[model samples]
Target: MREQLQELLEQRVLQCVSMPRNQLHECPGIELKKQSCAKRSAEIVKAKANGRIKRKFENQENESVLYEVHFQYLIKQRGLFYMEEEVEKRQVEFYKGILVSDEKLNEIDGPREDVEDIPVFSGHEEGQERKGFRYDRMKAVQYAERWWNDFNPAYKKFEVDCTNYISQCLHAGGGPMRGYPNRSNGWWMQNNNWSFSWTVANAMRWYLPGSKFGLRGRAVDSAEQLKLGDVICYDFQGDGRFDHTTIVTGHDGNGMPLVNAHTYNSRMRYWAYEDSTAYTPNIKYKFITITDDSDA
Candidate 1:
């Protein structure tokens, strides 16, 4: 089974590298890559996938097994005047020794429907008192790359941890924490308690732009305008509920940001999640450049 898992990873990489579009209909990522490359007059020159089995469960009752494969795909493309490379890390599940469905378990991040909507904090009305703090973009990117595939012991890990991880990156970059003891208030995670903005994607998405002080954000026009340590929020359903978030860690040859994120746990991934299972044609994105406007 282990050997077959490795073989499957290899075959998937090969398919992405050279398979026809009709044959690769199941691989949306690769198909989207091909479309992107065509638009830019680029061609994929190299591709590979390294797989590590994170967990496996076997059931003798029906000769079936489930394997959680951590897949890291490296792809290189060459255009007329530019060359670029990216790595996408995502966990895949296999059933009965092969993939029964490629749907990711940790993808969507809408508010937990079982619970009532969280209390909202009006950042604009109740402006937070912030001290002078400068954002360290390089340090944030360093922290992002350091822990993209792993969790830090110092922080609590959540099931849908995309925003939690991004908040950590911001903190690592010298972003100050505030609004403690109130989960609905300012961004913070301390003493085992946290703010909604620190863990909830939608909360952070709203908190940043509305925040008047302390680790605020300025919305930009597009992903290209964002610098390292900036953020991109996702509304996969375009229902006005922003769901997932990612921090910029690197940029491609074209200057578009390459992002690092949790939940799916990726690094140097393309900013637009065109291939994500949660993606819809109506997907909306919010490009926010993390700001340190004032300490007042």
Candidate 2:
């Protein structure tokens, strides 16, 4: 099922990439490039908001470009039934917050009663396109900014909210939530409005955080002991400050944690954990575990 699903997702992505932009619009429109999906999605919402488009569901020839067949299935099984409504609803609340209408809310109150509301398509990935793929967090942040802006801004926002932002990107990138938490549900929370714990720890499964094991585990006896996707926790000035967090997106050939964080600054960047920019020598470190949810 995973293989089939992955294949379907790949094919959809390729189709979106290979399909001509002009062919993607229902009406005569501009050509959409790979970098423009997020921007376009933002524009669609903006146009609807400005009354340029009278319809909620704009006729999108390129809808096929942004999604995969497997994603559609996942949507039916996971996101779609709730996505259009949930995303619209949350986006409005995040943006407008309590000022949105009860009448508009009523429209999506019930389940999609008709299975026909579900779309159908064969799914498969064409070939390997992972070669050119780089972890372009800056571009991801740009897309995210446009996305977050179209909605309400009352919900807690973070700079190096890398994990949270990545979660959003994954959703935008066509990954289904297997049981993740958002700020609303509180699967994760911030500390004093600015702290991080960029590792995953299920209370039901792991003890005292970082107890859950498997993806990749290593002891960071020194700064040299980290790699991509590895986690970093804070220990404030030896008084035990597990008060901050970040993730390692890459590493130097010598092995240093390339971190992406917010707080001090909002950006995906590289850092030396042992260096005392944010700490002192008495500040001890813990395990920098890793998890690759990509193939999952």
Candidate 3:
């Protein structure tokens, strides 16, 4: 039974690379159907999947087993003027050696709502010109690439960790932290506790422009205006609430951003997220350009 499960897991891992058109993360118990996107032209040149058993147990009648697998994907992609490789990962659950559900592990845990009001920094003069820290785009991008599919021991890993991961990348770029102990105000993570803006997608999306000190960002009109180390907020439901976040780590030949995220564990993925299972035609985005003292 173990061997049979292992073989099935391996075959399922390899199967994701076989169909690139859909790219949508499959929910448990649903067969992924290919959907056409007009802007998708990048071709996947090669692909492979690797899976490992995370846990397993016997079912009620002992007729089958229930278990979880950590599935990882390696893909080589080609575009009009570029060729690059990416490593993406997700988790899957199986019952009785049959695939039941597959998705980014803990998709339900992330992208929290804005439950608290962050107070404004009294020391900051909103209208007055202020010099900020130098944001290192290269360092941020490097950090994104280094840990896209892995978790750092310094921080707590969440089941839905998109915003937390993006905050780490911003910190790598020299974004300062303030408002410790005040979980509703400012953006700082300390002693296993963090501000809403530090870990919540909706909070960060709102806190960026209004913030006067520490990890501030200016709202942008389009994704194209963004450069490396910038952030993008996703309102997947298009109900005026943000649910996910990603960082710009690279770009495609057409100058579109190639983002890295944690929840789905994607690397060098298209910024539009048309491939995401959460994608909807009504989906909206908030583009943020990380500003530094040089902006003055």
Top-lDDT candidate index: 1
- Whichever of 1 and 3 has more lDDT, that candidate is 1
Each model's TM-score, in the order given? Answer: 0.83, 0.32, 0.77
lDDT of 2 by residue, 36-83 (tens): 223322112211111111223223321111111111111121121211
Tens-digit lDDT string for candidate 1 (148-246): 878999999986788999999999998888887778888899999888889887788888888777788889899899999999999887887778899
Ten contiguous residues with the weakest lDDT in model 3: 28-37
Candidates' C-alpha lDDT: 0.74, 0.31, 0.68
Q: How does candidate 1 fare on TM-score?
A: 0.83
Report how far off residue 293 is in candidate 1 (Å): 4.3
Task: Pull out the clashing pairs in model 3.
Answer: 28-101
Better of 1 and 2 by TM-score: 1
Compared with the true structure, the alpha-carbon lDDT of candidate 1 equals: 0.74
